[model samples]
Target: METNNTKMFTEMFSEFENDAEEGQKQKIEEINEILDEMDEAEFYSIFTKEMFEKIDQMIEKKKLTLENAILLLKHIGYHNVIVKFFKFDFHVSSLRFRIENMITEEEKKKEGKNEKPLVDLCECNLLLSNGFISEPIISVCVTYVLKVAMSKEEGEEARKDVEMALLALSNTMYYFIEQKLYLKEIKDIVQYHQEHRNLTRLAYQSVWQFLFCRLLCDRRLEDVILNKLQFEREAIRELEELTKCIDWKKNEDKLKEMEEENLLERWIIALNIYFKEFQIRKKEHVVLIECIVQIYQASRSNYIEICNLCICLLKVILIRKNAEIEDLLKGGAVEAVLEEIQRPTLDDEMVYHILMFFVNASRRLKEEERKEMKRKVFEKLEEEGYEDTIASLFETFDFLNRKYYDELSLDISNYFVNI
Candidate 1:
């Protein structure tokens, strides 16, 4: 079987399909050799310089200046080389200041404390922004250490390295996902990060970093993945686990984990998912219902989530209570949903949703709403109704149509022809 590192490389290469294999292989090999004698970062600078030089030479031959060649290559896809060059090892460009501050803070710990003053952190930051095609570089950077944590011998020190690497990886990936080049890579890293809880700091870092990345990733990714992003999901569960590598003596990391484990984070995730739905269709009222369902099931205990849940619940009651679902049937919305939910051998969960949908139909009732509904039904039945009454019934029925449980069993073949 391929090792975890090999597997990660495979995942990263999944994109850039026509990757000049011979070229990239020769490139990484030549780059690695040069890096071996110098620094891993040398690979990033050298490869970038060499490739761009050659591209510039070619462009210059065509009479284009170096800057124009660079710009044109970016527009025409040679930017992949720069992206690949980042795959080696990415040290945080700004962690020194942050680490120093954190170290100083550690020295001033209130009382008895065991927080290690990050003796030394291998600085790795690849100044990535959300506007470039650098997702693959992110994948390669993060997976380097994760592969070790997942496969190399199990040890505490190795785990800390893994955790730190992952934090930096996740930090970089936020920029990658925002850049919109490699979701397949982000998904892979998320899975790896969630797999085990190493240092409390690392574990919390992975979760926060991932949640942050998810917030920044392609809205389309969440659009399709909304239902599947749950931590309970195997693919996610496999990566979302907390390993035993964290240094809990550091109260900060432990506190961070505790904070993230609460429900407020989930509320944000749910909100993110629903926002994407709204983006796709502005008047998709059904999304409100869907959002509520997700929020209700989310076992979040954070007060912020609870408050948000309360607000969302109020919205649900406002929209759904005393809703007139009858006109919705006539308006074609009800028919559209029934057609999908009425499938044979429906999944149990979906069936439960249908049952609850009807149950909700029975609740949220208002006496005036019912009277108005009855008046509309009678008017529809009476062929003797005046023009005013006819218009009123149409409007009234549409309101009721939103909450009514009546089914529209259009013949399947007729449904196709009518459409």
Candidate 2:
């Protein structure tokens, strides 16, 4: 397979290199078809050191267009060749310089020819997707697109060109988030466009997609939240600004609004990350609990998912060895869970997490305190029309109960009987 693929790829390149203008469309189509059918192993088999050097030489000799070189790089550099081959950096650097020069050339060209390089450079951006291209190159592309977006062009042709550039940049945004060298500038560009130009909707969304892409791609998604710890004094201030940016009350009132904002879901995701990754410090704990409780209380009907998340966040925080469980109780966290569980729309998930919250909070207390808290919780449940739910708690399987309370789980289970 290796020898066959190598021979085929080498022959195709030989044909293209020997006659640059002969059957250009046919050759490009043939190259695309062959590349489409080639899998990772077959590709690696054919793309050798000699082929990379030859392509580099062709670019340096001006025998092949930079566009064609980019195409070749896309095919040969698949499956992390850029990362594996040190020599590929030369090709990458050359491509970067070409793209920068293209940007400069586009700036100097009149309207008629300006779109030509935009189309070509857009091709370069698409080829640079995956992991083959370096961050510096993508940063250069992003910086160029952002500059185009920022320039105050007056005519219709210029505006259309700028929009095209933004759309092109949006197409490549998934590749842009890996580099932080220009992230702040990229964000400021997006924010500026969002604030200053209603016409830049496409550009703004592309930059926003960059952030969402980073969140999806990052394995440690909570690191953003964890980094906030360093700014403890300003944490609440920052959170307040975030909270005020959206009208939560309006969101609570309308389903469409809630779905659009999805603020609670985003907040819960952050909380879950902090719950899993970091110890809940006193200040962080207080702020988180207060935030959760406030969001839960202010939330209206059909918010079981958010309610359950708040309960789970509470449960995780309560279980922490250094947790100030008293702060949660003082903030009416118990009442919030109890209220949510007794709501007519409650589901198994909500009940389960809330019950886990009780079990966890109970185990951390002294025997007398545990019994007292359990008694109060059951009384509240019964008063809130949750007597049957309380009974079901005792009848639940031991494994589920023990998972939260160990041996004390049985005692807690039995205590439900008397209530």
Candidate 3:
């Protein structure tokens, strides 16, 4: 079987190398002309392995040197050939099935020299302290591996690789952005992440990570003032292309490892990086605030995280003094926070945060929009049979100047320049 397998692949390679277009003399001659001029070594820049063991070894050693392949191709300086290989537009799945079956029969040939047919990413963390271009390409391959896992019906395993690749992609992409300082690509990446509204419950919180990672893609994504974070991707050019990627794997084991060491808080603190680096626009800034609001309002998580989120929102709303915030109250932001506070037996701390959320919301409104909102609130009250409640609430906040100004001592370095 092993001999047969070797013979089969050898035949395929020979056939591919020396294949003819049977009916077309012109086409056959063209292929010949190209092959005749080829530097065999450079053409085999991405060498195929007869043994999966060798490929697995390279991947395990973290020495699957695409460097040599990259260098060899660069030496050949033939972009057309490389482009032609990738641009062939083969459906990945059909080709993958073809490869899988072929690899399977070949694997069965080896006696007692086998492990798992698929490489174990968990056993080997393929991290490289590497370059910008290398990073994105690695991410592209990581995503491919994850797809393979998913196709094998290992969603849990696939998610782990996806997340790993995401982190790698982040490291790589930022390096590229920093190197090129290409504002257009940066913004495009940002917009792509922003447009990915992860409706999955896990995504809402993870969205900020997406923003923080991408912010450093071109311009930094942190805020110095208020020592905060924001996600503004208006600088990237082809965001749709960048963000068209699938979500990273959720490595539950990783989540558990981090949780044991109280690292989850640090994860939340990543938002501070974004808050510090990018100029948080009104809409983007409010998203962080609103995410916190929604999380707490759901009354689903533990008290500690909810409290931390409330406190952060308090600081953000106080510092920003945004005008577009009235829309949140309109969109039930007020109601959500209020619901959290009034949950069966509400505590004083929670109540205090709820009031602060209101105070911040009030400060965020423009005087005119506030009045219109105020008038609408009363109308809404009438519509809802709560006209009496409207009057009381309106009278309560009428004196209502409770917004915060940016602290005078705030350092510009601490805040991201909108550039």
Candidate 4:
């Protein structure tokens, strides 16, 4: 007796082999209806690797239209939510063949053959964009595509393959992290692209976004990414070496120059992840605080999002109380916050966080330290006309009726009172 899956596969294959497009569409729809009614185990039984090989054979023989093939993959991809231990080797291999053939067609087109490839590149991209495909399948496909992309020599053909690979990687990155598949090759490729400046602007942005998503989910990658960005060991070494021979004023200039040399885009990506996904570890507090303060100072005017994230992360650090206030103060956190408030378009959320940072930092300081902090802040405020800045911010917070407006306002006012 044939199982339900075996029976459906028989019918689907029969319909696929038919010459009439309407018959094929009808058969596909009937099979889709059957698949829609089946549960995970049933779907798994019908969509196995052997089944995909059969479909690939049909695809090769020109028996199934690209639309039919894509529809079948779409169903499998959509039902990916329930199936476990999915056998995707055949499908991935088929996809690799399609992509390579598409590139070959692209090269041929340049040489005067206007023939399009049998597979639809856009449909393939859309299929991967479902965001439901399993990591193993995506990993295999991405590995193959990136290998092709990197190995190709400089030419239009290489650029097209690279663009296709980047788009596919971007679409599948969400699943990559969701399924906890951290491919080291992907990390290496993203890092290489960052330095090479070879990809188009859109592709460049896509790969960086892919790295950002991966970093957000994998806590184990934190140190690796930070070290690459020089926010860990290298940053500490540089700071130590700079302090050996320089006064604070000259040190500030040297640090600013060093920070300028680093990529602002990378800093923004790492900081966004640090702010949203994970807390900075205690050991990272000193270096990260210095890094955040410097970047905030460098970007306060031009990059509002980075500045906002910097302030929010600083607030987290202060509330956790893992780092000493002296470290924050000496790292120029106070000056960064002051300069941030001077921005003309400060939102209520930003204002609330900025005030909260001050409130949290001054909470448990010693009396002498409090006095010194107040004197230092007041001098800066007086010199920069930040007295009016604070007052205006207070009025905005008061109008917004933010939950901690009263507490934050009083704490900041008391903390900065002139002696």
TM-score of each: 0.29, 0.46, 0.32, 0.49
Instruction: Kindly indicate the candidate among 1 and 4 with the higher lDDT.
Output: 4
Q: Note the clash tally of each candidate.
A: 37, 0, 28, 0
List candidate 1 segments past 4 Å from native. Answer: 1-161, 172-257, 260-267, 270-306, 309-419
Which candidate number maximizes lDDT? Answer: 4
310-356, model 2: which lDDT tens digit per residue? 67777777776435667777777777876766675655555567666
Clashing pairs in 2: none
Global fold similarity of model 2 (TM-score): 0.46
- Residue-wise C-alpha lDDT for candidate 1, range 296-384, written one tens digit per residue: 33322322233244233323333343223543323332322333233333343333333344334334435564455435434442444
User: What global local distance difference test value does model 1 have?
Assistant: 0.36
- Looking at model 4, the pairs that clash are none
After superposition, candidate 2 runs with Cα above 4 Å error: 1-256, 300-302, 320-322, 393-419
In candidate 2, where is summed lDDT lowest over 10 consecutive residues?
Answer: 78-87
lDDT per residue (tens digit) for residues 102-154 in model 4: 54455446456422232234325333333544444455455445564454356
Candidate 3: 10-residue stretch with minimal lDDT = 410-419
Q: State residue 116's C-alpha deviation in candidate 4, in Å.
A: 12
Candidate 1: 10-residue stretch with minimal lDDT: 74-83
Model 3, position 52: C-alpha lDDT score:
29
User: What is the descending lDDT order?
Assistant: 4, 2, 1, 3
TM-score of candidate 3 relative to the true fold: 0.32
